[model samples]
Target chain A: DVKVTQSSRYLVKRTGEKVFLECVQDMDHENMFWYRQDPGLGLRLIYFSYDVKMKEKGDIPEGYSVSREKKERFSLILESASTNQTSMYLCASSSVKGGYKEQYFGPGTRLTVT
Target chain B: SQQGEEDPQALSIQEGENATMNCSYKTSINNLQWYRQNSGRGLVHLILIRSNEREKHSGRLRVTLDTSKKSSSLLITASRAADTASYFCATFIIQGAQKLVFGQGTRLTINP
Candidate 1:
């Protein structure tokens, strides 16, 4: 079984503070992604990384950035957390070997920016 | 912008009944996937259907894809209370290293 683990299930931060959410996958997948899910908005991609130190912006990349220093770990950074940034952040990883290899997701990190 | 959108944002059904959710996408896709997420939990991949294929099934779940309409439907047979969760349809577009775009998802409630 594939296991994707997130650094935190719940976190709180003050406005303008820097925040980091970490994700680690045990399956050695080549693709990793960060998304923020909101009611009526669903899961909007923030960033994705296909290889070490490589990153790509998704539809809603503003106010968010990501890092993939190693294959197993992917990090999402908020330069200046704001109340509007509060959301359920999800981490997912997938293998690109076959056509649409399913993505495995980690238990989301619910960040509250106060 | 979200590529896919799910209809009937919320659904309720009896335990023995079947639950169905529909998703529509904006662009061409190589394949479509369905995932289940219990409230505040990680998502679990349920099934995937390629653009060339019309329908696919796994256990009690059935998925159908229509390329012309750029839509898909997921059906859960004999749904149980445990099946209550959010069902999302995701598609892998043919562009830009093939990123997966997810829909808003349908919140399903299976009452016992």
Candidate 2:
């Protein structure tokens, strides 16, 4: 079974603070992604990494950056958190071997920016 | 921007009844997939149907895809209380590399 684990289930931070969300997958998948889910807006992609040290910006990557220094670890960084950035963060990983594989998601990190 | 949109943002039905959720996407997709998320939890993949396939079934779940209409439907037969969750339809666009565009999920409630 594939397992994805997030660094935190809940977090609180003040405005202008730098926040980091971590995700690790045990399946050694090649693809990893970060997304923020909000009410009504649903899940919006923040960033994705396909290989070690290789990352690509997603639809909503303005205030976020990602790091993939290791194959199994992906990190999402908020340079300077804001009130609007308070939302549930989800991490997912998948294998790209056989076309598009099913994404396995972590429990999610609910960040509260005050 | 979201590529897929689910209809009837919320649904409620009896435990024994069947529940169906529809998703519509704006662009051509390589494949469409459905996922379920419990309250405040991460998503679990339910099923996936390619653009060339019309219908697919797994366990008590059935999924149908219509390329012409650019839509898909997920039907959970004889729904159980455990099936209560948010169902989301995600699309992998043909041109998008390993990126999935997700829809605003449909929240399902099973009345026991």
Candidate 2: tens digits of C-alpha lDDT, residues B1-112: 4589998799999999999999999888889999999999999999999989999999999999999999899999999999999999999887756468899999999999
Q: What's the distance in Å from true for residue A101, model 1?
A: 3.4
Deviation in Å, model 2, residue B99 alpha carbon:
2.0
The C-alpha interface RMSD of every prediction is 0.8, 0.6
Give the fraction of reference interface contacts each candidate recovers: 0.94, 0.91
Per-residue C-alpha lDDT of model 1 across residues A43-76, encoded as one tens digit per residue: 8889999899999999899999888999999999
lDDT of each: 0.92, 0.94
By DockQ, the best candidate is 2
State each candidate's clash count: 0, 0
Q: Residue B83: error of model 2 in Å? A: 0.6
- TM per prediction: 0.96, 0.97
Residue A71: error of model 1 in Å?
Answer: 0.5
Tens-digit per-residue lDDT, A20-83, candidate 2: 9999999989999999999999999999988999999998899999999999999999999999
Q: What CA RMSD would candidate 1 show?
A: 1.2
After superposing all C-alphas onto the true structure, candidate 2 shows an RMSD in angstroms of: 1.1
